[model samples]
Target: MKLSSLRFFKEIVFAACLAVLAVGESPAKVLTPDFVDLAEKLKPTVVNISTTKTLTPQFRMRRQPSPFPDPFQDFFEHFFEEMPRRPQRERSLGSGFIISKQGFIITNNHVIAGADEIKVRLSDGREFKAEVKGSDEKLDLALIKIDAKENLPVAELGDSAQIKVGEWVMAIGNPFGLAQTVTAGIVSATGRVIGSGPYDDFIQTDASINPGNSGGPLFNAEGKVIGINTAIVAGGQGIGFAIPVNMAKDVLPQLEEKGKVTRGWLGVTMQPMSPELAKSFGLEGEKGALITDVVKDGPAANAGLRSGDIILEFDGKKINEMSELPRLVAAEPIGKAVKIKVLREGKPREFTVSVGRLAESGDENNQKTAGDAFGLSARELTKDLAARLGLKESRGVVVTGVKQGSIAELGGFQSGDIILEIGDKAVATVMDYEKLIKEYGKGDVVRFLLRRGDSNYYLALRIE
Candidate 1:
């Protein structure tokens, strides 16, 4: 063969090898996704929310010089019922997402909390008046409906329970009134509790969530919303919190059906079982919810659950943390029987408890009442009082009024505190408390066990 022919053959072989290497080797790295297409597809589902609130003037605007003299000014001010008083209308802006093609939108409860009128604007520049369907302040979630007279785009809610930390997530909202803004970041953390409420399982992320982003949706890579951007820590950069979509899914149906969420009540206040508490209780592991108080005649009480019992498991699920118990109990079916395992008196015990529907907390009087001997007025802790004070049970006498500068007030006794015990003796009734106090005279130091807002502590008072 000629030299030219041999060279052409080598070139052909090299070209073939290059084609095979190209098939085996991967392409250049794309650090991030091309969010342009995804943003365009998701923007239509996101909406901008503007609300108007009506406020009445607290002080009358300076009155113009009246024709009458100053002596008649007092009479005119009191008698003028229909003065030209201007009612102030305050406007606020936020973000929301369409959950249904029929115009059902979801946003933060705070956004539309006191709004007299709520308006929703779409990416297409169309606006519509929205009606609040339901709201849950505890979760900071609200659902509103709008009549756009056309088929609207809907965003799918993803299973937030399956989301992992460091996963890429997108937040779409009207941040700082800039409508339909999109920001991306990875999930910085999960199950974060920033002291918002009892159900404070927030997904912490680095996404730029601002004031208007309160109601916006946090989406996964698949374009599905896994969380709702609800809060941002002040003076922090790239630190934001979102309510997991799984939590919202749990209460959304109830909100839509009953206009409120009905949580299952175990009637027991609880705290984390610390390592020290676990060792003291003869437990091997630092896992369980330490029961502080048991509501009298409530589900737990009727089930033989006591205040000192440490809950290890509920409804076949393990209670690894204190916060886990609330979410588990709240997810329980109302009126359904569930098995609860507890460690009482350093022994494992189990009981079957019937869940009860949570009732609304009522207002209690905040004035001083009776007990001049102790410089405090006390009453039986009623169910309403327990609910109002966030107590687990109505098992003891509650301090209704604490006289200032008195021994009770000086000893740190406050109104709404439930007196559980006096120096190792249980005081369930007002008579019991009075009798216990009668045993302690002046110059005596009495230790009182008290329950206040889901916490239990002992206070010592030196009788004067």
Candidate 2:
């Protein structure tokens, strides 16, 4: 080999060895958080809550005829009807965290709902009686107070909006009657809806939460309270949900002052936009909420929002999902004017609407039958029928019955479903439904807007 070539080969070997040394010196560090200090620092802020409820049993008069005749039967029935029933006591356990030095604490509304008595136990083993100051059933949040006579340790509140997926979180609670248990895990997801209620934004974590852990605190790495442990999936391991601290913070003042929550109402029944519905409306993608029904003289109607308009934005926030709009609207101040952007006839339009207070009521009625083509029978909705069916408006045809193994059944149609619109046109009566059904022939696809229970959605049916 030539001398110069030998020299060049040595230089290359030296460079490769240097590269290997550099790589060996800089390996990534896997950090495992030591939660002992964090847990100890925050445990004093957490409390174990126990609730007691009294259930009174009622005796009812029996209508059945007794074997004894006349006077004897009447005497026996009177004796049984006048018998005194015992009042049973029900006890439940939960957890909470102190929020203020003035003895204010935050817990789940369900934890102390209908509770006749409540007790709180601190980490120092001191116990005190608690009284519910205020509660909001919609948000499932409760504010309670205790006369501790001394300053209490309070947990620092953190911004849940800053929380990222895969971040370390610690949950401290009394799970299954065990007090002051600490569990650690990472955030699995955010903004999860488990069909719990209308505003169901939950933080998903793998932190072991159980029955007794309800109303506990979920702490971030800095030992700040980020979420309130609220729910768990039945029979599912490592899946627990917490209410974001931000949402709780938003209503805490109202709960403390009013003892209830007052939400703003948009007065529109909406359904999620699907790709098929978007295409039918000449849109390329499904990114907005489709209005099924607008309450007459309500906020949306007053703002000129009509059925078939797709809501693109509420206030200043873009609505990416149908569920987001309700939460956004509910959080707005009542009587406040807000801008709503919508797509109408493939064109973008905006409206300013004054929000109204939500007034919830229930009832719905219906009769006439059109069956055979769709394998379902439907009738015109009447005001009396609407009230009976728990509907607020009488503006649709109600499904009377569905055929077995038919298109209606296969398409998730059930008896008692209110058909609000057929093929983007409102079906106010059985005559309207019949007229719309005739417009679509065999092989044509049609979309039906329906209200089942408190939810609204679209179902597509293809003519045979």
Candidate 3:
């Protein structure tokens, strides 16, 4: 064969090799979405909830004059009952999702609080009147129900207990009344508390949740609902928190079964006893909630529990701190017999106690009541502070020193204030208060009904 013919054959082979290589190489990454489908699928179920609450005429306007202007004060209050001297219309917006086919939806309680009318607008442009099924302000969660002739789209609930930090997540809500807006980000953290309440184990995310996004769905990458957006810490952008679906699950059963939550009470005030206090009492580990006071006839009392006793275990789980007790106990059923382990005076002891139902606290006398003790230095309420606060208590205990702005101070208790009760019982004597304080190895709260002069006050001071 000729040299030119041989060269032509080699060129053809090289060209074929290049063609095969091109075919084998993977294409540059293009969007083959996992989230786009999620957005489309979940958007329909996410709804806009608008609440109309009537506020007193006084509440609508600032009692303290606005620093900026007062041009509308006189004209605003006159002729317009809506102006807020008597009654006025107050409206707000939030986000929600249909959790059931029968129009069961979920949102934040603050969204619909005091709302005389709740209107829910769907992704399909249809609107319906929604009724609040139940709400728990302690958790900042609420369940709403609407009338729908058809089965509504329900988002899938995922196990939040399985969620991890830094996982990709999506938030769907009505941001600033823009319904069904979707933002994407990763989970920033978990188990965060923003002074919302006890049991605040939140899933933090960088999703763009704004003013109207409260009570919306925070979905995992697999399109499962893992959390419900509740709040954003102030001065924080790209930071928001959601109630873990697991916590939401705990409240849903009660909301569906009963219109309100019924929590179990041990009638004990408690707190996380510091390592110093724990060591002084001979506690083995630094963990466990310290019982400040066990109520008379309360489940804990019947079980031989006492103040200064460190609760190590409830049922089968170990108690790590005093704040952990309420979330655990409230999860228990009333009247249920359960095992409780405590470290008494440095020794571990165990017992069984029947839980008790909690009832409304405080009464008309504005007399002191609730909790078990006030750890601060206190004395019998005198006529001086009573006259100053405009309260009428003569025998109630007065707070002399709040330990230099401790939890009591932050709880709105001042020096010279009066205390009324522990948990639910009245404290008429320092012995009564001491007994209550002794029951708690740590301090959770000292419920007080106070008299300052002509005024009576109810204050819950967090001891833990």
Task: Name the weakest run of 10 consecutive residues (lDDT summed) in model 1.
Answer: 361-370
Any runs in candidate 3 off by more than 4 Å, and if so which? 1-33, 59-84, 360-464
Per-residue CA lDDT of model 1 for 292-314, tens digit only, reads: 76777889999999888999999
Better of 2 and 3 by TM-score: 2
Model 3 Cα lDDT, one tens digit per residue, 219-321: 9877889999988745558988898998888889888878677777787867556778877988765898877666777778887888878889999998875
Give all candidates' CA lDDT scores: 0.83, 0.84, 0.75
Model 3 gets an lDDT of 0.75
| Residue 120, model 2, lDDT | 98
lDDT of 3 at 67: 32
Candidate 1, superposed: residue stretches over 4 Å from native: 1-31, 57-86, 361-464
TM-score of each: 0.69, 0.70, 0.68
Best by TM-score: 2
lDDT value, residue 433 of candidate 2: 81
What C-alpha lDDT, on a 0 to 100 scale, does residue 160 get in candidate 3? 99
